[model samples]
Target: MLTLPSIYVLDICVFVFKNIDKFTRVEDTHNVNTRHKKRLCAPFSRTKTLSGSPYYMAVKIYNKLPNTFKTEKSPTLFQKKIKQYLIEKCFYSVKEYLEFCPK
Candidate 1:
């Protein structure tokens, strides 16, 4: 039951990543080349509460996803993968989900 929110948040992240083009890749906005270029650029936040805004939370969660999950091109496959992953992990909170390190 608790995992439902994590699954829902993951779905929202997937939607923003696949459908919304406003979020820029880390590589696009920076000059110093980094190996992890696929990450989304997290917007600046004035406070911790502001950092939890939908846009910021979406990027944070999306960035933490496995590379394979992030690269999935098909919406159905992405949803399937995320749902399977969340069910297996059974994350109870957004913070726990954020700190997950998939094996």
Candidate 2:
């Protein structure tokens, strides 16, 4: 027969498992793709951090900007505009931006 302490521990475990199932059900319908869409829709997506490394974040941000603003003819200007936008969005400090956007 199980002791009182053992029964209490089992009860707590069951409660946690049930809550976990509920949370998973709620999150499954709105997975990472849905979150990504919501992030993109937000005005601050360009400045937001990616799930991976800073390089990935920079590339993702670069890809999201309008093509008209990212012509090869003026790559420096394009980069400057992106940096300015990130700063305006209050994503990070100038130091952090430099660390993330290394040449």
Across 1-103, the per-residue lDDT of candidate 1 in tens digits comes to 4366776676776787576588888888887788787788889877898696888888878887888887888888887888778878888888878777542
| Consecutive 10-residue window with the lowest summed lDDT within model 2 | 35-44
Residue pairs of candidate 1 with colliding backbone atoms = none
TM-score of each model, paired residue for residue: 0.84, 0.29
Model 2 ranges with Cα > 4 A deviation = 1-58, 92-103
Number of the top-ranking candidate, with TM-score as the measure? 1
Model 1 scores a C-alpha lDDT of 0.77
Error of 1 at 94 (Å): 0.7
lDDT of each: 0.77, 0.38
Name model 1 segments beyond 4 Å from true. none
lDDT of 2 by residue, 1-103 (tens): 3444333323332333233332222234455554233122212345435434433433334334444443324545544554455545443333344345323
- Give RMSD to native, each candidate: 2.3, 21.8
